[model samples]
Each structure stands twice: as C-alpha cells, then as structure tokens.
Target: MVKDLYPSRVNETSQIVRRQDPVIHNENARTEGPLSAEEIDFYEENGYILLKSFFQGEELQKLKQELDSTMEDHQHKEGPDIIKEPSSNEIRSIFEVHKDKSYFENLSKDERLVSIMEQILGSQVYINQSRINFKPGFKGKEFYWHSDFETWHVEDGMPRMRALSCSIVLTDNYEYNGPLMLVPGSHKWYVQTAGETPDNNFESSLQKQEVGVPDEDSMRWLVDQAGGRIDRATGPAGSVLLFESNTMHGSAGNISPYPRSNVFFVYNSIENKLEQPFSGKEPRPEFLANRENIQPIQPVSNKSTARS
Candidate 1:
C-alpha cells in the first residue's frame, strides 16, 4: 500500500464486519462543474467518486515541474520522505509537499477543493498531510490491499475516520500503469487482521507487520457481498478522486510503458484533529503528522492559486 496514506485503527482481532447497506445514486443532481449535492451523496454512500478531467493544462504543467525539480534535487538523498522502490531504485513517492515548496502550498487552500471540504467535513478543516505518488512506467511497485483509516487511527493517534483524501492526477492514470483500485463501499467494514500494533510510525511499521489486510477468505467474501465489485480509478491527466480514509484500496505493479503520477492532499475535519501518536514509537516527522501549523483554512476568501 502507499506509505503516505492514513491507516485504520483496526484493533487486535480477526473479524470481517458485515455491514449491509444498499447504495443508490441520485441522477437528478447537477452533473457538471464542482460537486453537486447528489454527487456528494454518492461519495458518502460509495466511499469515493472520480471527477473526470477536473483540472487541466497550465495547472498540471506547474505541478509536474515542481515534482520533477524536487525529485531531481533530492536524488540520492536518504530520508523518510524520499522513498525509493526496492527493485528498480525509482522513486516510489515523495512526501510532505507543503514543506518542500510553495507550489504545493496552495493546494489545500484552493477554493475548488476547500469549498467541497466545507460541505463534506464542515466549516473547519486543516490539511493532515500531502504527497506525490509515482508509479513508474516499467517498475512501478504494487500497493497491497489495505485500509488507510487503520493506520491513522492506531498509529497516528487519529481518534476517528473524519478525514478524506483527494488524488489530483498529474499523469494519465491507466490500468496498465497500476491505477488505484478499491472495493466498492468497503469503508464501512473494518477488518482487524492481526493482534499487534505497529511498533513505530506508519511507514516503518508497514515493513514490520502486515498492518490492516484482512484474511483472503474475508476479502473474497467482502468483494462478493459488499456490493460485489471493485473499481479502477482511471482517467485523463487532470482527473481528481476523492475517497474516504477508511476505504480499501491497492494497486498492482506497473509493467507498462506509461507511468502513473498523482498528488495527494489529505484533509481532516477540525473537529477531528489528531492527538499524540498512541503507538509507543518515536514521534512521526511533522511532514507525516502535522501538529505545529494547525490553522483553519481561509479558502473562499483567498481565491488562491500556485502563482498567487
């Protein structure tokens, strides 16, 4: 699974919760522009919704430039944020964008995103973390099936799953490029796969334990019973995907000629701010678990952009 994501607080146990909920989308809501009421409802019901071609052109180009330059500048550097693939040595992901450059600073405060945050989360919210995931063309790695809320809850001291994440596509996300895949409506069911908590932070803990993956039998049962479906989030270079933190998501290794790249912004409701990490591990880097700069965003008033 992607390292920079939020994990669930699936406690020490082995149980697959069977939550029976039927989802029906409302086709009457406005189907254009930013999220409509019906669209938001769909997200609430299914755990995620892809906004096709939500961004484009210059904005995407600038993000690409910032990502490329940052990667180039940090080549060979060793740290938690600059993670590299084990086999190909390609950069798997770059973490904490709001720390490294101003280009990513405006992402959280953009009206386009923040307004929707207000609608789904509430009037008060702040960014939890940010990162750019790179699934390289030929050697992109696989992110095994797991739930993000389990990590945030158990490791990061997040009390509940009040946060959500958005993936802003920078490069075309195709099936062969290992686009993200998720089990439909799996957010409501949590599986406590193992009986141990991570000894350390989320990223390092992933190396130490399986974290939150359910047993194979349970997964098969959930896929068939929990709406019996999986979705591949594929779209053009400017698409945006908003997903609940607890959702089950994973991706296969990209052995294709095209690479998949996307910038992620995780927003947590101010009402659900994090407490100190409960895991007896050392404190996570600020980039991973932000605590210092907790300010309610002023997006609508700012009309912000990267250039501004």
Candidate 2:
C-alpha cells in the first residue's frame, strides 16, 4: 500500500476544503503567440524552462479543490494514507481518486492551458495523460533523477519519438520543499541503455543517498557529459516547468512543514504516429484527447521572462 504523507490532515477528517483563484499575470499576456528563435534556443540548450504563473490563480484553486475533494473521498476507501495531512508520509498512485466527469470536463475547458500548449506544440498536440503528485510537508520523499520518455511509449515495437511533460506547481517550491532538479542540455545525450528497464530502482538509489550527492558516479558522469550544466527549478505556486521527454531531472525530499502538490499533463506531437495505444485506459472521451498529447512540445511564445 502507498504510504500516507500527511497523517494529521487525513486523520482529522475535516470536510473543509480551501478555495482560491488562479493568478493571472500581466506580463506579455496573449491568447496565442508564436515562439521566438531565442526562446527555442534556450529550450534546446537548457532542456527545460520555467514559465511563471502559467495558470490563473482561480484555475489552480479549482484544480486544487478537485484534488482535495477527490483525495478526501479516496481516504475512506483506500485507507488513511490517501488523504495525508501536512508532514505525513508520501502518498502514491492518486489516479484512483475521484475520476469524475466534472473533473475531466473542467480540465478540457482550461483555455489558458490549451492555448499555451497549442502555441508550443502546434494545433495538433493532444492530452495523453494527467496525474497529480501530492507531497506533504516533511513526509514527502524525493523523486529520483530520470526522464519521462524512458518509461512511456507505445507497447508495440516502434522507433522512439519526442514527447513533453508539463508540470504545474500548486504550492511554493524551494530547495527544502522538494524543488525539481534538472540537468541542463542532458536531453541531447539521450541514449537507450541496452536491456535497461524503467522502475523505482533509480528512486531507491536516491533514497539511500544524500541530496546533491549521488551514490553512483554514473549520475554525475551523465551531468558532466552535458557540460556540467545543471539547475534547480524552484518557484512559487503557478510556476510551470516544461521539459523535453529525454530531459534528465529529479526532485529533493520535502523537509518543510508545508505540503507540496503538482499536476502533470503530458502531450505528444500529432505528426509522430504511435504504433499502438499510448495509455492503458481508453481516451479521455474529450475532444482534446488525442495520441499526440505526450509528445515533445514546441514553444508558442517567442518572448520568455528572464530566469531569476
């Protein structure tokens, strides 16, 4: 069974759910825009870029509300581990929580999300998968360094294709709160390891070692091979991190007292054909559902805020 990260919050069993609005940014706001050459260069060189307040405050609040409500219901059926309180153990596999039609409907109508995605991947980009990562204060464990593309693909034999995973922070993320650590430009060095399988093996290694220190030199070697380029993605709520499918990244453990949550949406390019179905479940039944939902993403806006 997956461990509960926030025992206090879940055990109390209060129905009170917090609600807030999505914060809209005034910086270069536009419904649709093409990515500039320099912005593309940054992604090519850095493997990932942090987009500030990508979702409005209200939208984020609504999603959070849905997550909380679903998690509350999940606790009753799946045990106390499902609705962990702040400073509890990490909870895993939250997909089973409240798979309601309204949840899918709300996600489908997220205009800003859809608009930004369309700009980055063209109009053909589709939603392949959606997941919520709930990490409670001090109880949340570290997510080991790796790439998403290394795990997901068409079940049938086929050539590897590019994909994208978009992560939106629902709470403030700092080093102590388990901010994401990325190896810049590592996407270009992606090489399929012969007979290697994707699983928690990598995470196990991370759990046994200290943060910023890898037990195996191979991890260091990989980053060094990428010209020693690395960066820790830390930001407040609403920050969005978009990375290529092959980008090497990981996160530290949450040592803070505040809970951390991030909702991930994976997308693919429509031009790249899949040999078989990408997900085990049927399509989302929404118009936006498509095969290209998890493919590598192109930037829609040429203008990018300078990294602070």
Candidate 3:
C-alpha cells in the first residue's frame, strides 16, 4: 500500500499541509533540456512558467488545424471522454487525447516537450491525462479555483505531487477570455479541503466542480501566501504554460468576442504510479486517469522526426 503523505478531503476542517515533495525533482545534476538554469529557477519559485511563442507559424497552424478537425470528428459522438457545456451542446473538453494516434499524440512525444518533462520528473514519464479544453465566446463558463493534486490524490490515487501540466494555447489568451490564472508559489503548500469524495464525482465535477474546490478562506490564505496576488497567463497563440500539479489555478468566464481553447497535457513520473484511491472508493474512469498501458513516451529528435 502506498503511504499517503498528503492527505486531503478527509477532515471537517480544511488544513494546510506543507508539501513533502520537491517542486522540481531533478533541480540539480541535470545536463541538457530546453529550460535555462534561470528558467528552471523561475519555475521552482513561481510554480509555473509561461513560454511565449513556444509554437509559431507553421507549427502553430498545424496544431490549430488538428484541434479543429478533432473537434469536428467528435461533434456527433458522445462518450465519457467528451464533456459538454452546462447550458448548451458546445463541447467543453475532450479527455484522453494522447491515446489517439493523432497529431496530439505526436506532439506529446516531441523532444522539446518530453525532455523538459523528463528533466523535472527526474525519470521517464507518461501521460497521466491529456485533453483539448474549449471555452466558447459568450457561453464560456468559469472554472473555480482548486488544486489539481487535491482531486488526483483523493479520487485518482495519485500518491505524490510528482506530476505537472502543460497547456499549449491554441488561441490568443486575452485577459477577458478566461485564460489560465494561478496563485504563484501555491504549490509549496497543500490545502486539505473539507469534503468526502462523492461516488462518480467526476461526472458532475467536470461541468462545475462543487466538492474538491478550495473554499473562500483557503483561497484567500493561498493568495496571501503569494503576497495577495493572482497571476494571469495572457499570451498570444502558441504560448505554452507549464504549471506544477499542486498549483491552485482556474479561469474566469469568457464574455469576450474571442473564444479560448488549449491543448493540455499532464505528465507523471513513472516512479509515482497511482495506487488504490485514498477516498476508499473505486478509482476514476480510465479516461480520467490511466493505470493501464502506462507506457513511457519515446521522445523524437525533432518535429520532422515526430512526423515520421
């Protein structure tokens, strides 16, 4: 049985537990990767780093096309993997995308992405989850503030905070368009929310999270720890935001004319494979968390190599 170092959603009162795991496991003794020493340091301090224009021109265009085409392919389909908006049929998110043999799968194994994931994880890694999230203009809804690690630990049996997410912006992330926002340095502490895990929580949680989210007091406390500031990741198309798993993040509703969309990937170290749920319930569906076929990604040498 895996020992639960970070316990959450078990107590009546929310507790602030100090993080036991390092934010960047392979901080030192690393050789080659895309991140500079300074950039790595920034990620260590802020719990996130934005790479502006990480994909551009041809690369960006191809990703956009693939995103549009994938959405079209799923338009008539319905499954546990596809989540729709609360009010309309507009798709909110499509999960487990890396499982498909599509452009997204290729992007997942691109050396540029895999190398950085390997460096931070200090070992071989595999996709914990992958999705293309969409927030359409006028109807886009808000995502409440919460720590992903809190949910993954209690519901999905993630043992530690050795995972991270990369959100590749597919459209201009304007301030008003519900771009990702996070409390800097929030990853240093784990906020134990007050709740018991509901059976099949992800079914409704994906539409509008009610149980695992941090309450108002906890949110204030987390922001205060970061000097009472919330940072928004507003950037042009092709920008990428890499954030730690425990980082408290969410986005506002998009009432602007432009829609917001991104291809998001979660990578977990092979050493931190999930165990039985800490919630004492059955694990979430395979579409939400993968325990089977957890294969390490083989990084390609270049974009052309990924194509091959």
Q: What's the C-alpha lDDT at position 72 in model 2? A: 58
Tell me the tens digit of each residue's lDDT in model 2 across 1-308. 22211111112121211111111111232334444445555765676778877655566676678667766556545442133333443344354221245563345335555555555554455555565667778667777776555344312111243446778787887767778889886665533332222222223332332222222454676678767866887887878888876677888777789888777776655543344323222322222223333443332321121111
RMSD (CA, angstroms), candidate 1: 5.2
Q: Which stretches of candidate 2 lie over 4 Å from their true place?
A: 1-37, 78-90, 96-99, 154-159, 194-218, 276-308
Clashes of each: 11, 30, 0
After the best TM-score superposition of candidate 2, give how far the Cα of residue 252 lies from its true spot, in angstroms.
Answer: 1.8
Q: Candidate 3 regions off by >4 Å?
A: 27-31, 305-308
- How accurate locally, in lDDT, is each candidate? 0.71, 0.52, 0.88
TM-score per candidate, chains pooled = 0.84, 0.65, 0.97
Worst 10 residues of 2 by lDDT: 16-25
The most accurate candidate by TM-score is 3
Residues 1-308 of candidate 1 have per-residue lDDT tens digits of 12322333445556765433222122332443257777877787778999888777677777788778877777788887777766656676788886553667666677788766666664467888888877668766677887776676666666666778889988888777889998887877766566556554466643333655667876787688566788999999889999887788888888899988888899888866777655545656777777786888777432334436
Say which candidate scores most in lDDT.
Answer: 3
- Report the C-alpha displacement of residue 147, candidate 3, in angstroms: 0.5
Expressed as tens digits, the lDDT of each residue in 40-74 for candidate 3 is 88888999999999988888888999888888889
lDDT assessment of candidate 3? 0.88
